[model samples]
Target: MNHEDAEMELTADSIITQRVIARPRPHRPVQAGGKVGAVPDAPLFLHLDAVTTILDSLAREEPVEAGGLLVGHSCTDSSGPYLLITQAIPATLARGERLCLTFTHEAWNQMLDRKQKEYSEELIVGWYHTHPGLGVFLSGRDLFIHQHFFTDAMQVALVIDPADFTWGLFYWQNDELVAANGYYIYGRSDQTYQALAELLTEYGVSWGIQTEEVDYNA
Candidate 1:
């Protein structure tokens, strides 16, 4: 599978674009429950180390925002869930300058040209951006742009709020807009790890019950 180089309808000049490679859609809905563990098998576990690495790269450049492509493996086992196996942080662009989100057209054409040459086939799966003074949630303009251009539900959208150190995930389901159910992950702190783990555990219990969990991890 390959994508062509097309102009991205950026919502802001400071927008940073990232991508992740995903398997073709799963045959099943994965799970029908509403929370993380609700459909435990549907939950994705991102490597804390990998996530940390991406953040560190961004931190190294400070004021300027960074973006890149995410590559990972997927399965449907107990370990069947999606995991952020690895990541590729591209060069950084100035915070207030907008640029079209493209992988050289040549890169996108080959799907995994560069990575494949390195013996990997990870493709574009999602995007992430920093919200400096802006909040962590997706703005109206952000939603509109994402939906209009990238309509894939498996496509992940992340917003990082540097000021408050908060982060969020978003995914689209047909016409219904939805966000990931989990605690925020950011910076060098592991304070939210325990909460996130507990939340996922409860979500697993709720999954068996065919309902959404009331609790949320911070």
Candidate 2:
């Protein structure tokens, strides 16, 4: 089978369940230059539970980098297509260092096996990795991985700097990956997002910044 066909087969076999949560509206104001607003076609919605799980795993990794695959359900609404991340599966078998992480073939197979056996209802929506001291930006290797593995337009890349307590999401637009200006954090209460914002701000990493365009060619 071809690449697209292979992806479809993989997804069909792994994704066995779909959960639809309440659609979350953007709470933040739009930034100037139209760089930081919800995309009409595909907006990313991150679940608070997923964020907490990822943060916990990052904490466990400490100074070293950690990586994981995002598993969730993709849904659409009147606004457009949106992905709701419900789970974060840590790559425990990954080879990690202070500056880099490589997900081994064994890890990939194991994750796929678990997805098929346990999380048959969830799909691999994207990926996330800690940057440690580095800021929230995708490196050349990251771009390559996104292009090859996470080729879906709705797929996103999340970069978090545990040292700085900063994070950003990268999405595909106009055939290029660009930093998302805004995203929704849905949970039982708005206070969840408020507390997270406050914590990031206390760490000197404000989340309210304009979406900066990225140049993968650089």
Candidate 3:
């Protein structure tokens, strides 16, 4: 059946599912980077501690692997190498089920409904899911679903590999998946720092942000 028919079916059901109506409200001004201010790329900065905390909480040996939507505003100007708006932690869910084609339609609708009630029409920044064992990257099917739903937009795909306490974020560009260079956000120790540094050097900009030591083992 088509998406329209699927919606009709869902509306008739009795389950209490959140509806994807619209973002509840416009994001209050934030200070990140993205084209919202004409910068070539959106500046994204994620707190490593925040990421670790979220992953830890979601993987506490509970059966319902945690998942949720990211909420934030767009940014334009910044002193650093990248621009970023900001995001807030609103609500979270213990994903009732794993993401797959079978559940994609329902999940999308539910997510949209939640957005409508919470953030108003803002786009999905990314999604987070706990990998009980699945590791930190999109499965082939997940990639296909992402392309189907988020074509031509800069949406983030975040996966948390709980066993190793590591995470992965994928940035989409022109239908091809590319590694999001984290040097601008995480500094030198980040795996992608050197790659981003090279890009900066080619652009005649200095990648002189003082590199901080990251004790991944900490």
Candidate 4:
């Protein structure tokens, strides 16, 4: 049976589950990068905690592909609109292979349930999957999944290569899905800064944290 037959799921949850319905409501506005005014070219932002969660989930699966959902909100400030991904909830029930991932009905339901219970305040921004050693690019199937399931124009797909520690974001550009230029990982400057430093020590991750450090402050 096709997932199109599934009962109407939660609004935001349905989209991730391939049962598109409605877009998430406007979440509170936030300030990220430092610039002000109409800076329309803002980049995607990933929360420090979210990045670690995704890395841990994908890494634990090793050579096989692993997938999950990203939860966050879309907000616009002095610099136009941007996406902020703050959580990565793994799809433990999904089928994964060396270069493929299938979001089974059970898998989507579990992820949707978890997001409702745990991250009630956030929106389902997109989904993330690993390519193991295949590198960071979406295949035809990947694009199909994003287009048919994640319908909202802003919803994106994140692809990662665990073997190389490389990743990229795939978003809707006009009528096409394209790789984003770059993204930012953010957190509370001091404690978050220190914790991130320790968590990503081997990767040479560093940030100058003073009272607060948002690349574009609004």
Candidate 5:
């Protein structure tokens, strides 16, 4: 909302997201706070498809910073609000160096166009960026980008270290960024996560799945 952040704007595009949210059940809420919506340690449901895309992008642009938007639905339930990441679209036109990644207007516009044409109903729940060898944690510039473009309280910031293939998710907690200790990976019953499983184990990151449906009214 500042003059310097005016050029790149999410503008009043759309934030009414539940209309297309993915409802994966047998739910166990990953509550970060006592609130009823997204908070620190809030559950994040990531789809295999999205994870695959993220892995591929990170591999292709290794040793340099790269990034893109996280496409999905932001929904709240009996547990609270969780992000169901359904897709990962890289910013092919983005410019970057070892320590910096800039989401150019062209890159940003490209993502918006794809989201509208392909995943028209889904919201941009958050964003993910690679740190190459630098490791996970947002820099001042990264925070600025997230604060300006991904303004919603439910929105998240994911940092990935392609060097070690380690990653982390951060969300707002009383206007401060808080890291999640674990998350959930939801996908079709047939999908395999052998590769991701190894990485999660290596990093000591916990994950889960809710195969059964939840009965909220029960």
Candidate 6:
């Protein structure tokens, strides 16, 4: 189906439920130099509002790296397990440099408090950060953070380059990290999805669903 059609279906069925399933353990061997090998079967779905929020936060922190934790729930459809990211909670106490970000203990405490108070039903599905002009790829430090904190297989890391609007998502698979070539953004209204598509297209990124099976060794 096309993007419009897919959005329509998702909007018609917007009730997202949380499911408790055994976390997929990392088993894929890490390649040399910590480079990601291939795209995993898991997919990520973001609400249109969540995307807008992330972009706005990134724009506000221009020239320096900015990041935040993602809030959402996981569910299994006929297609398989996927994440539905509904919120983007910016790191209020994060220290950001040109190439790195350090989330303080206060940041973690605040995030946990907010999750308990406001988003008790959602999980910290992943995180996102901007790279300024550095391009879209996970650094060694980024890999370390993901491995230690977000160890769950479904947890993902999103890297966005505000200068060029390029972005990528990385997830754990077979003990290795895999970059997602494509993802989905579900909206409750047609205008929302249209705006999202336009935004991604204007930034030179493909917003449509990926059709080709990811070749891991490529």
Which one wins by TM-score: 1 or 5?
Answer: 5
Where model 3 places Cα greater than 4 Å from the true spot, the runs are 1-42, 47-53, 56-60, 63-65, 78-109, 183-218
Q: Which lDDT tens digits does candidate 2 get at residues 1-218?
A: 02353344445334333445455443342121123433323366676567777876765635877887888777765555577777788877776777777777666666677666766677788889988898888988788778877877667888888775767888889889998765555444445445545543443544443343222112
lDDT score of model 4?
0.66
lDDT of 6 at 153: 65
Evaluate model 1: give its TM-score.
0.52
For each candidate, the alpha-carbon lDDT, in order, equals 0.43, 0.65, 0.43, 0.66, 0.66, 0.64
Ranking by TM-score: 5, 4, 6, 2, 1, 3
TM-score per candidate, chains pooled? 0.52, 0.71, 0.51, 0.75, 0.75, 0.71
lDDT of 4 by residue, 113-174 (tens): 99889988777888999888888899887877777677787788988777767777788888
lDDT of 3 by residue, 97-201 (tens): 443323344554665576667556344555555565566567776676456543434456655555544455567667687644442233223446455434334
Model 5: per-residue Cα lDDT at residue 176: 81
lDDT, residue 204, model 3: 34
Scored by lDDT, the top model is 5
The candidate, 1 or 6, that scores higher on lDDT is: 6
Model 3: how far is 126 from its true place, Å?
2.2
Please give, for residues 1-218, the per-residue lDDT of candidate 5 as tens digits.
13243344466674324353445442432221122332334567777577778877766634778888898877656566567878988988887677888777777778888888998878888889988878778899888877776777778888887776667788877888777764565456543445445544443433232223322324
Q: Model 6 segments beyond 4 Å from truth?
A: 1-18, 21-41, 189-196, 199-218
Question: What lDDT score goes with residue 135 in model 2?
Answer: 82
Taking the tens digit of each residue's C-alpha lDDT, what string does model 6 give over 1-218? 12233233322112222355444311121111112333434557667567777877775635988888887877665445767777888876777789988776666666667766888777878888889889889999898777766766677898887786766778777989888755555555444434545555553544333333233323
Runs in model 1 deviating more than 4 A are 1-42, 60-64, 78-85, 91-119, 183-218
Q: Total clashing residue pairs per candidate?
A: 11, 3, 24, 7, 1, 4
Q: How far is candidate 1 from the true structure (C-alpha RMSD, Å)?
A: 10.5
Off by over 4 Å in 5: 1-9, 14-40, 190-218
RMSD of each: 10.5, 7.5, 12.0, 6.5, 6.1, 12.2
